[model samples]
Target: MKKSSKDSVVTAAILLFNSKGYSGTSIRDIADAAKVNTATIAYYFGNKEGLLEYCFTYFFEQYINKMEASFATIEKGAAICLKRVVADLLHYQWENIQLASFVYREMSIDSQMVREIMATYSLKEKYYLQKIFERGFEWNEFRPHSIPYLIIQLKGLLMMPFMNTHYMREVLYVFPNEKFFEQKYLKDLYQWIDKTLCSDIQIKKEAIIK
Candidate 1:
């Protein structure tokens, strides 16, 4: 399907912002990348800040929808749900690395646009994770701990791989753009989640018995 002009602009903006950052990227850069005039971006999105806000909002809206769909189809168990959530998160981050990168960069700064996006979408994202954690607690699939801390850890796990791509390429010589690196990273992530957060077989059995 042919992408709309606005969609094209947003896609271009994501890449530019991810690579050059919010302050470094310009409206002309996005326009040139999108093969459209600057007025086109202005038409679709009022300004640079407006475009950034729309980009984040659109990304999270799609993310939430996908998460909801995954939750709906997955088996009714906390362990199963947790695994699916982690898998989905990993896949999404990998597929949308540019948007993920842009978001990670924006998160570190203090800006009204960032604040609004966080309050509007980031909080909702946190709530979804919290619900999963709550379910795990009730099912005894996860041990008791601070929900906020767990959320932070989970977000960090998901974001770190994409955020540290340069380090991975330079220090570890792992090119994330390669399928080999992506698969290996994802496998390691799954193992980390299983080891750190999941209940052992005996614990699950005891919980069931009780």
Candidate 2:
């Protein structure tokens, strides 16, 4: 299938935004990379901020869709559902590393876009995660834990690699975009979920207490 001009522009914008901070990237750079003129970019996105909004919207829409799909398809306990959700998220970030990197970087700053995401997609994401945790608690698949704290940890684990790509590459000597890193990081993530979130001992303790 042929890619649309809008998609091209978006792709170029993500690349530029990932390489250069959002403040540093310009419409002209995206236009030149996308092989489209500035006028076309303006026609499609209206302005650079508009293009950024589209970028964020597109990323989160797809992101939430993937999360929803993962949650819906799982019929198992909360532990399994949580694992699937994180696994899907992990792979999605690897597959869309540029956009993932850019999105998380932008999320660190305070802005209208960030506020909008927090209200909409971010809240939705948290709701799904909270539901999974709540289900696990009800079914005794996971121990009782603070949902907000767990979510903060989960977000940190998921975002750290992509958010610190330069450090991963230069300081840690790990290339986040590589398949090797994905596999290793995913293994560690699963361990964290199992040990921290779904500890059998913890669950058994809660069960005994009840």
Candidate 3:
């Protein structure tokens, strides 16, 4: 699909902002990369800050929708649902590593704009995750744990690798840019989730039988 001019600008802005900090990137740079006039950016996004918000919103919307879609046909149980959600999220983050890195970098700075974006979209993401956890608990698929802690741990698991992609690539010899690395990482992540979150219902049943 041909990207719309607005999308083109936002895509260019993500790459530029990821490479160069927000303050370091200029509207002209985005315009040149996107092959649009500077005025087009101002017209579409009003300003650089607005463009940043739009970029966050665009990518996050895509993430949330994909997550929701992953759950659509999942009637098996919370374990299956959680597994699919985690897998989809990991794949999405890998696919949009630049955006993930940019968001993580901005989050570390704690700028007013970043805080605002977090307050808005991140809350929604948290809520969705909370619902998933709630379902897991209700279905007895997960052991009882602090919901906030679980959320934090899950977010850390998902974001840490991508946020530290450079370090992983350079120091750890983990080439996240390669398909094989992501596949292996995702497989291990799934195993970790199962071990950490999955309730030992069979064990409990065996104990009851005894």
Indicate which candidate wins on TM-score.
2
TM-score for candidate 3, please give it: 0.86
The positional error of residue 23 in candidate 3, measured at the CA in angstroms, is: 0.8
Writing each residue's lDDT as its tens digit, candidate 1 over 64-172 gives 7767766764347665766677778777877887787677777788888778778977887787778887877776777777899988888887788778678867998
Q: Which stretches of candidate 1 lie above 4 Å from their native place?
A: 73-75, 202-210
Cα misplacement distance, residue 14 of candidate 3 (Å): 1.6
How many residue pairs clash (N, CA or C atoms closer than 3 angstroms) in each of the candidate models, in the order given? Answer: 0, 0, 0
| TM-scores of all predicted structures | 0.86, 0.91, 0.86
lDDT of 2 by residue, 81-191 (tens): 887888889899999999988988898899988999999999999999989888878876777899999899999999899897989999989999999988888889988
lDDT of 3 by residue, 54-143 (tens): 777777788888777877644666766777888898888888888888877777886787777688778877877777778878877778
User: What lDDT, from 0 to 1, does candidate 2 have?
Assistant: 0.87
Cα lDDT for residue 42, candidate 2: 93
Greater TM-score among 1 and 2 belongs to: 2
What overall lDDT goes with each candidate model?
A: 0.78, 0.87, 0.81
